[model samples]
Target: MRSLVLIGHGSHLNGESAGAVYRYAELIRERGLYDEVVEGYWKEEPSLRQVLKTTRSTDVTVIPMFISEGYFTETVIPRELGLGHQGPVPGEGIARVLGGRTVRYTLPYGVHPSMSEVILARAHEALPDLNPGDTALIVLGHGTTRNENSNRVIYQNADRLRESGHFAEVHALFLDEDPRVGTWPEVVRSPRVVVVPFFASEGWHTLETIPEDMGLTGEVTVFEDHPSGSQTVYYARPVGTHALVAEVVLHLAEEARGASERGGDEDRTHAEAWHAFMALAQEGVRLGEALITPHGSLYEIRHALDEGRPSDALTTVVTPEGLRDLTRQDEGGRHRPVHTFRNLPRGWRAVLSVTDLPQGVHNLYPAVVEEGYAHHCHSLRATPWPTTARRQTGIYAKVSRATPEQVEAVAKDVCSRCLKTRLWAGEKLPRTFFTRVPGAIPCPEACTYFIAEAREEVSGKRSQGGHDHG
Candidate 1:
């Protein structure tokens, strides 16, 4: 069996940071090229450290959905995946034999030559009517002084566009380093310019910071009384969000798969756990915010609140990806990372085949089936609050100084907002009243958001020169 794992840098502040990664994973899964396709993140659940354990496939291909071959792609990800200290070299790729499986790591998609095509396509899509010869193209990247490779891809793409002679001028701009986005007016000579962000996902930087720095108000911003004369600017979405990028990932995965030897057997334990969960689902089980019930050969999954509603009454989602997208946001249109939040909207139901049931459940509530199976087997490794706090580093390291009372208070507050039962807190704290569901999902460890909140509480108390004894 073979698996494909896409890794990205998820954010605690913005759930959409990993949106593109999830979308690509689903797209690839629909193609049915691999036995399994999953996503791992640095700052989100089903994290990099534990993503491998969930996959039953023996031969796995890991791809980084990052914009550059820098710190994250080169250092952090490899270390987290136990691949070694250095990342895979571009084009050649790298492979390692670990834990009875052959894991192949590939160069990030951003460094691929195909990215230049994605950038050009984005530029043309943003301003189709405008003539490329009269419009200047700007590839905006979040460059850093720490990693020179981070800036290389941007320059390479700009040079490629220049060689193609599609645009009157191609300029590369950065958010942090020299030739910043603010200097766009002075850098470009064309009267019309299109700026395309070279980042992976549209999060804080693309949505807020880049627009603010570039004096852009909307898709088309016109400057009448500017220092460099009147010019019309068109802003394109991030290049990584383009649909064609999925094809690039597939190309990389195929190349790596051809080069590596696949021999290890499937993870029988994971298969057994999935089978056990399926057996429970056959008798109707409530997992997280979903109420899954078997209807003949198909499983009908709906919000736990809509248990009694007839199938015709609720909106039916035909595809698994459709249901995943439907629940990606809340009623207010904000991204909800905690999929098990009680507010799973209303009047939406999904009918999935027996084969697709596991993917459907995972899309709605990630990693729940595995956790449930582990809990049933008495093998769930629930990390306590103290151990979780001690694992923190950098600014979050101060979380260790928080009093037990403060930790308890924060856990109660945060867990109340989420539907997952806090298995991490162990027997020290009583279970939240709402999370007493018999087959509810389990949280094996404190999430990054919980750690952030704990750090804030500890910092606030220290600032006020007060401590809570209780």
Candidate 2:
């Protein structure tokens, strides 16, 4: 039978993300709609790669457990699964994916019509003791300044909820971007506020962040003596995790099964990948360093290649041909590096890697396959380089965090990124990649980074940015 795989953005910080995905998957599986129903996650196990391998079904459907057709749905998922070279299409699409599987990729959850009832049901469940007319409703979302599309359904649904005339006021707030949730107290006119979190799960945002951001004393709490009066914010569970979402997943899967194919024949290019790249560019993710071959170096390297001479200054070149190609295209304008290295969403993602993230193995300096792709994680993980004194080449790194305590936090964040990326690149993630900094006192050439014992405080422009990335 055709298997169904539910993809979720699980949390490295909390297990609730995986729990919610499993809950939804179990609910769907109990119906026995498919031969197998398995779940996959980005941040936690069983990873998307592991799930793919575990499922022996030749025919399958992968539904993104996201609210909208945003970055995860568009870029990351497609890249990981090797489905859409172009990027995510709206709603659903049929793609001849890897492993020769006829995978039907579904749109995120929020677009389904059944979701409106799900949200309303959640509100009704949360407001058993209060009156809907006296209570204001807030659709809290994790909005993004990077991609405006992330919250389009949120505001649209908020308007729909307001039109229902069941609440005193209906407003939308986001944790990331404007309409900041903090400003709700000033505009909220009701004594009771029911917050239906528009998150994928009860991960960081729903359980920890939204509650902390709202300054609630408990999950369901009463804040006495606000300017508006004593207000009780009823923090409802995430709509995505609500049992009704199982139906939504089935709805999307059925839609995917019914729809005809809409992807291109093997070689067609797409603007969606570029759009996702540009969207990410606006999001302010800094690279620890870009392993960019400068125009002069690029030219020198090309000349060397022509003359059969190896680059002296270049330690580990990404590729011999792509560097030459980039150098050939430099026409005086700022030459953006085709790729970069960082401790990020995963490891070593290209600055514009619309194709993949948790990109390969982490590189000390940047190297690339130009507009093409190249990452070395699988080989690296399977047969790791021995960090021997013979290849000892140490270099210091400056972490952005202020204190050693914060330094450890940032270090662990980077470690999490490595593990996250490794899952995508190497197909299996180590439970823990590192504790403090990776490398030893006598570092090796293939070692990702080398920092001595005790993180020396980075007190420069790099330190200016907040440690939230950690």
State which candidate has the highest TM-score.
1
Worst 10 residues of 2 by lDDT: 435-444
Query: Candidate 1 at 292: error in angstroms?
Result: 2.3
In candidate 1, stretches whose alpha carbon ends up further than 4 angstroms from where it belongs are 11-15, 74-76, 79-99, 127-135, 165-168, 190-192, 203-234, 255-264, 328-335, 340-346, 384-387, 416-423, 428-437, 440-442, 461-470
- Cα deviation at 314, candidate 1, in Å, is 2.5
Compared with the true structure, model 2 gives a TM-score of 0.54
Instruction: State residue 37's C-alpha deviation in candidate 2, in Å.
Output: 0.5
> Each model's C-alpha lDDT?
0.79, 0.53
Among all candidates shown, the one with the greatest lDDT: 1
Q: Tell me the deviation in Å of residue 216 in model 1.
A: 5.2
What would the per-residue lDDT of candidate 1 be over residues 1-470, giving only the tens digit for each residue? Answer: 88889998876546667778988987888788888888888777567766776778778889989878976777767866778757447576788876666788888988888899999899989999767668999999999997888899999999999899888899999999998999987778788999999988777899999999998999999999767678999999999899989888988887773454453578776788788878778888777667788989999988888889887898898677778878877877766655665667777899999988888877787776676677666677888878878756556789999898887778666677787778777643233212335435667877766776788788774223222221
